[model samples]
Target: MRRRAIPLLVAAVALAAAALTAPAATADEGAAPAATATDAAAPAAGADDRHRPRLYTPAANPEAYSQALDLARAGLYRDAAGILAMVRTPQAVWFGDQSPAEVEREARQVVRDAAGATVVFSLYNVPGRDCSGYSGGGANTTAEYQAWIDAVARGIGRSEAIVILETDSLALIPSDCGQDDAQGTKTAARYAEVNYAIDRLEPLKGTKVYLDTGHAAWHGPASITPRLVKGGIAKATGFFTNVSNYQTDSANSWFGKLVSACVAYVGEGGDAAQCPHQSWPREQADAWIAANVRTPSYQWKHFVTDSSRNGQGPWVPPPGKYTDPQDWCNPPNRGLGARPTLNTGDPLHDARLWIKISGESDGLCLRGTPGPEDPERGMVDPKAGDWFREQALELVRLANPPILPGS
Candidate 1:
């Protein structure tokens, strides 16, 4: 979900939505939400892309389910509810960005209507989630962060939700986001809090959780292993690498391979002779395995990529004189990648998902304009749905995904 605070000048959409959305029910007896046709449309499995995994989502997030239903109705259900649990609207965010009381009331109603949905959640306000922009914003104190996580866990209650935990926390550990202020203590607490969140969310029988592994561009194989450890990767079912960001399948696949290799390398210890990245002697491979990759702590998950907005891959830099790729934040010409679902090829790459929706802009850049603005198109932001549609169709062709036997 987009996280920008809509200025109070309030677009008519916000006002109209607030004023006219169907009134939700009270705690005692809620109005049942209308269900979509049981037989929704879904693309036939790709001939070779048979690794179609499904992401179980809990109904705590009506918006996510609705989005999934939309995809199903459009014959894209295979890619819709495939990714685990997708977040609806976090109460903290609704309260902070739009309204407090309204969000509180609406949240309960949403939860009620989303009874069987399997949810995937994100805790955006961890103390040092993102170092700077695009994905920045977190609590100041660890205690506050914990309180926020506790609330989320409670909101999840017994629902079958897949939580994404916090994004970018690992990458930002050594960052200048005031982590050095209290030195190791603050850093340690960040992990502690994440661990706390995992423990709280995972106990529910239906919940399957994963922690964040920054994008392929952000952290190298060896670098991310220890970071994932600190972020409590051992405790979670697995860790997700690329979320709500763009990276070609080729690049993410290579990155995931290296990270998995490195995790194995480090777990065994830094014995270069044992772990070989190149064509090495059999002795070296065995040695590497002995020295690394042998952790009894946990067996992590296959990775997942955000096919969203990557129809045109990462924003390529122009010639030698690069003005801006516009890809760093949100570029206007972008579109939704793959809809969230569990069918990526690599056993390590779990899902090809729309981690970030296409039409939503990433707010303002370090400069002024919203990152997705396109001056040539006279499109200054992510409001119009055209860019998203164009990009989505382009990606569908680019992927040349094998359509099901019968659409």
Candidate 2:
């Protein structure tokens, strides 16, 4: 579910007052205007793109990129470059509110702009999204969602891409969240919508479709495998885990392997009822897989994990601080996880990591408190998708494997 935040009217007023007190400057204060054709163009800035795998770069993250440049001009090179590097990594482009034509056009442009490089696109138009809570809106019905997905498929039009189909669609089922409406209709149209997307997208040349499986911390293999099967995982390229959440890579990878093994088990006519869970001891789980799952790991359903924000693992709230910690919501001290890469060494692991969620955005943390500010941080968190300056800086500074020079 999407995190919720309280309004920060007090902070807004303070910021307004500070802005009024500051000295006035020209529109292009820090950087000069672009040079005209008559003037020789300056050399293009150097970027460390060689080692990085080709990921779809969004047109630009204006606010975050601008702030990074300002910091660079101020001689904060480490901080500046860190932010700049993040923009280079491929991130998902969500197509929720677009018309069929608009969505197709946008998708075609994105794939074409990628220039044959692999890009990730997220389809998030499931009806009754988020149980009608935060991030509530989606297509009004399953048919609408199918049409939207069809437009997206047409947009890609044979371009090589990875489609992360309908985040939280299966993981946050109504039964799990105590809201049967998530099932959509008695017939479970949610599964139908997903299957439709897979059928439409999987046939496209060079396209890989990955259904959402929530995170390791949320659903175990036994629980999610049946959902994946029902949602048509057999036809998909695979599934994705830990999207937009902060779960350690080891945990996610382990969970993914279990889920994959379970899928294979069920495919072989074995009962998922007897599959080992994430809670089982590692040795026990491995033993079970070795004995029961006859398929090669690579031949089994592959999976990828969202390693965008799990570097330092999850944040630990001070004991007794709040009645409910809401740890996943824009938690403090969390660092950037591993950078995006295709050569993950493990065949079962299609990719080591991905920026499934944009790192610069906030998570709408409320921390179980009511009111105008996040009680835990004593500040109002930014709404979901808004640029989070402080969090961005923190991610760069504490990045695991370090977002280093030329990296």
The lDDT of each candidate is: 0.48, 0.72
Query: Which parts of model 2 have CA positions greater than 4 angstroms off?
Result: 1-53, 73-75, 181-187
79-193, model 1: which lDDT tens digit per residue? 3322111122111111111132433344345445544543345446676555645545567777866666666555656765556667676766734465466557767877787
User: lDDT tens digits, residues 186-219, model 2?
Assistant: 2377788889999999999989999989988888
True-vs-predicted CA distance for residue 118, candidate 2, Å: 0.6
Residue clash pairs of candidate 2: none
Best by TM-score: 2
TM-score of each: 0.63, 0.83
**lDDT computed for candidate 2:** 0.72
